[model samples]
Every structure is written in C-alpha cells, then in structure tokens.
Target: MRNQVVSRDEWLKARVALLEEEKELTRRSDAVALRRQELPWVRIDKAYRFDTDEGAASLGDLFRGRSQLIVYHFMFGPDFTAGCPSCSAIADGFNGFAIHLAHHDVMLWAVSRAPLAKLEAYKRRMGWTFPWASSFGSDFNADFSASITEKQQREGGFEYNYRPAAPLTSRAAAGPVAEYAATTGADAATYMRERPGMSAFALEDGAVYHTYSSYSRGLDGLWGMYQWLDRAPKGRNEQGLWWRRHDEYERA
Candidate 1:
C-alpha cells in the first residue's frame, strides 16, 4: 500500500529530514570501505589454473596486467547447461561495468566451474563480452568457498563468510531455490551444488594475495538493479524469484 499523502510543505520537511540521514549513511559507508581496505591480505601460494578462451591461464594471468582483480563466482556448474539466473542478473550489471573497471587499472572476470565450451556458448547467448573463465578442474572456486559438492555439502566442513554454512540436504526444496534450479537444466540437487560469491585479489611482486571476498547478502551493493530498486516507488517489492535474464523478459 502507498504511504500516507501529505501536504507539499509537509513532504518537503520530511524529504529534507531524510536527506540528513542519507548523508550520515554515506559518511558511515565511507568509513566501512576504508576499514575493509585496511584488512589483512593472505598470500595465495597454490598453482591455481583456469581454462580461458586463450588457453590455460594462471590466477595471476587473470589480472590482465592490472594490479587488482575482481572475480565474480558465477554459479555455472559443470552439469549446468546454462548459467544461474540470479547470477546472470548480477552479471547483467557487471557486463556494463567490467569494461569501465578494466580501463581503471582493475580487471573483472566471471569464474565458473563449468567447462570453457559451456561458458563460451552461454556467454554468446547472453551477449556478454566480460571476461569469463572456466575453473572446471581447478580448486580456485573451492578454495574461495564458491563451489561445493554434494559430499562437502553433506559433511559440512567448509566455511562461508568465515562462518559455518548450513549443511545441504538432498531434497526437493521449494521457492526461489527450486525455481532457479530448474532454469539451469540440472536437478535441484545438482543445482544446489554451487553457490555464488565474489573474491578480490591483489597482484604485487609476482604474487597474488587474497584481499577480500563477499557472499550472500553482503553482495547487495554490487547488484546495480537492486540499488536502483531500493530507490524506486515500490522498493524491490519482491515476492519471490521474479527476475530473469534480460532476454527472458517479455516485451511490452
């Protein structure tokens, strides 16, 4: 339902009051960002490799000569015929911003567990030019806690966001999880095998260091659509998995 309508003078007063709070939030967000940058960085030593359009490339190569690298842990498992719709939604935003980030001494890539061929075909279908690499036989996704198997999900030994993640059970779950699972051309069990996240790396002195990572709701700000919806009249107004790939949306 709509909020109460008030006089123009009253509305102006309320808006001005909200503006002050928004300014304060902006200041707090800046401080938090500064603190995030101040976090300790852990050096990555393992030989992480990925399959790319230009053949095999090491984790360091992903930076593309940039000092910083941002990898979106796209949820496209080896068994999946297509990418996850939710991740695709996020990629829609990245597709536009990736180029701009590249020009600013930063590289952005979408890393998935799917083989290079599947990633290539889907990328063409989606018309995304952003760099996406396949980590099919690599531990890059597992090490970053982005990809998980039924065994890992059952045993539950890994940590996501520095906390114990809930164990995954093999059952037909309802709601968005099941809904999104269907679109991936995999059973719900196979679909739930993968999770979404993003990791940031820094390349310095011929070494790559894990600087930061975010998962689940921590990634809200990176989603451009939600950022816009948050300011809209209805403000998301989401009931369930109402989003899809841009091409999937029906024309008016």
Candidate 2:
C-alpha cells in the first residue's frame, strides 16, 4: 500500500470540518429535542399487546410495573434475516444507559416485531440484559410503521439471497457492497427499516405522550462515530453470526 498520509494543513482542515459537522449535529439535536417536547400526542386508544418472559402485556404495562414507560422500537422484524446492524449497534448502547435511566424513574425496553421466541433468543445470543419483548401478532409494529408493513411483506420482504433468487443470508445482505444492506442510510428509517430506533408513548399527567423516534439515517450523528470506525482498519463486527439462522435453530 502507498503511504497516503495527510499533511499538517490537511489534518487541520479535516479536524475543522469535523468540528463544523459536530456543531451542525448539535444544532439539529437541539431542534429535535424541541420537536419532541412539541410532539402532538394522542391517547393510545387500542389494546396493543406484547409477549415477554413475564407474559402478555398491554402498551401501558411496559413501565416494568412502574408509572413511566419508555419503549424503544427496536428494528428486528419477524421475517428479517437478522437484527439491523445499526440497531444492534444502538442496542449495544442501550443496556448501559438502561441501568442509569432506571435511576430517573424511567425503564427502558427493546421491543421488536419479531416473535417473542426469536427476540428473546437473540437477546440471549447478544448477552443483553435489558428487557426485550415481541410484538409479532399485534399491529403495534405496523401502526407505527416500524419495519415492513403487511403490504410490503406481501411484496416478498427484503432479503439477501446468495443468488438474486436464493434467500439472502445475513452475511450476504450486510456486506460492504450492500452498503450495510441498509438502503435508507439511516434517514428517517422506520422499524420497517432496519436499525431504526425510537421510544413509544410516555406516561405523564395520567396520559400518554409522544417523545422521540429515529430512522436508520436520523441517528446520523449520535453514534455516528461507530459507522466511521466501521471503515477503519479494524473493521466492525456488524454482521450476524451464531443467531444468523435464528429461525432454523429450534426447528430441528
């Protein structure tokens, strides 16, 4: 390889560019925080249900038997080949934050449209301790347009077939050529879009309120450093391994 090193001036320019970008990101985040406060929320009218280790639960029951609820709309759908690389990266940041968030009367959960069995199993594989639940049978995933819709699934769901026709595997789907296998580039990604992350209703004043949610691209800056690290010489462990065939693990 050639010694493609940057000169002092170029390095300074790069650093300056990064600082400018960081400032823009800060401005955008502050704007979004304001938007979160102004979010026009309506009462949760339907009886959305989810299955956890404890059993079935309503959307209101996600506070871990507490008053406030903070549900992260994790981006792993039942038909998805594997959890979103981006969401998994975000989730990697969740458990640590969860323990701390609990000190402030908030409980965090990683909820997905994947089946309880699949979601719980992956949770174990990732060695995550944070609470995770499944919204497989409910429209909770759809009403929010998290992942693919029933209609989109009707179009044969997104996959990474080894061949164009063969079912796509995690490795094949998320390879660099596939650009992380996430086309949204994290922009306003839905649960329907992989790596999308967001919280559900908040309970305040005996009412539920909308807070914040993000698509694959929307989380561009917060953990944005990780994606940069992905391109580093060390490479990112962003693809699935043991649980890649999660659906097949228990079948036989």
Candidate 3:
C-alpha cells in the first residue's frame, strides 16, 4: 500500500511527531535493560559438556577466560541435513561481531544438538568464522529447553519460551512449519524437536551462573536483519517464510 504523498513541510511535521514516540520507546527500552540486568542469577550445579572443534569442553570452559558468555541455541537437530534457515539468517551477522565481543571479555558461541562433523561442514559451507559447539548426546539442549523429547511432544508437557506449546498434530505439519522441515530433510515434528534461543551466563567466584535467557520473539533484537527491516520503509513487510540462507538466494 502506498503512503499519502505530502509536501516537505507536512512530512517534516509528521516525522517530528513520530520522533517523540521513538524517543519514548528508546527511554523505555533503556529502563527494561536495567531491569533485565537486575534479574537474579541461578547457579549452575550440573556439569554440562560440549564438543567443540578444539575438543571436549565444559560450560565454564566456553567462557574462555571471559567473565560473560552468550550462547545462541541454534536449531540443528541430529537428524537435520542442514541448519534451520531462520537460525542461519541470525548467525550470518555473528561472525562479524563475535570477535568484538570476545575482546570485550564476552565470548559468543552457537551451540547446537547436531554432531560436530555436521556443524563443521555447514560452517564451512556458510563461510562462518564464529565459534560453534556441538551438544550431541548432552543434556544441555534439553536442560535449556532448546530441545524436547518425543514423550514430551506426544504428551504436550514441554515448555518453550516459558509457556506450553500445543502438541504436534497433522494441522501443525502444514504451513511454514512443514515448508521449513522439508528444507531440512525432516518432518515438521522432527524439525520442531529442536528450537532456537539465546542464553547468557556469568562466571563469578569460580562458579558459573545462568543470568538470562530469551526465546521466540524475545530474540528479535538479536536478529540483525530484523533490526534493519524495522527501519525500512515498508517495515517487516513479511509474507509467510520468505527468508533463505544467504547462499540460497538466486542472483539476478
């Protein structure tokens, strides 16, 4: 749809009005960030392990001498032939900023349920340099609610994004879910067993503590592309699942 054409003066007046709302949003966001930082930390008692290119590593080892760690719970299941397209898009921006985060005493990593071999291959294909780890055969994904068991799926007893999700049924096998599943060479149920999220951890006094985690829509700010789209003329302007891995786009 087209916006109403207006003279420069009128457009400037409207823009100034909108600017006030934008400023208010910025102020509110700052307050929310402070509140988020004030959330209590939960000490991690379990010893979670992962397989990195460098070899087996514990949750604390992921910090790499840093006091803070951010892990992107990428949706790449054991049976998936490829990573989730949406996750791939989010990760596309990671490689560039990961080093900056590292130098700032924060290590960023992408952790997945897929085997290390598959992750390594896909990383090479995507030309990514960010650190990635495989949580296969580990309870990290399930413990963090990034993956669920078949029993949980069948019984509708799982929680994602801090809320219960509907059980997988034939109806759920259609639409964007099915489309994305097919692209990964799995059914909707198999594909959905793996979910996407981000978790933050803090290392203090020789103990690792989970500081924060966000899922579903909470991850919007982390997706760099969406940040840009929000500023575009048409806004998100999305229709269904229009995104693909960067390499999947056909050049004109």
Root-mean-square deviation of each candidate, in angstroms?
1.6, 8.5, 1.1
**Which prediction has more favorable TM-score, 1 or 3?**
3
lDDT of 1 by residue, 1-252 (tens): 569899999999999999999999999999999998999999999999999999999999999999999999999999999999889999988778888999999999999999999999999999999999999999888889897778877788778877987777645455678878888998777887788899999999999999999999998998889999999999999997788888888851
Runs of candidate 1 exceeding 4 Å displacement: 170-172
- Candidate 3 global CA lDDT score: 0.95
Off by over 4 Å in 3: none
Ranking of all predicted structures according to lDDT, beginning with the best and ending with the worst: 3, 1, 2
C-alpha lDDT of residue 40 in model 3 = 100
Worst 10 residues of 3 by lDDT: 243-252
- TM per prediction: 0.96, 0.63, 0.98
- How many residue pairs clash in model 2? 14
Which 10 successive residues of model 2 have the least lDDT summed? 159-168
Q: Please provide the root mean square deviation of candidate 3 (C-alpha atoms, Å).
A: 1.1
lDDT per residue for candidate 3 within 134-225, as digits (tens), equals: 99999999999899998888788889999988788888778999999988878899998998999999999899999999999999999999
Model 3, C-alpha of 127: deviation from truth (Å) = 0.4
Give the C-alpha lDDT of model 2: 0.63
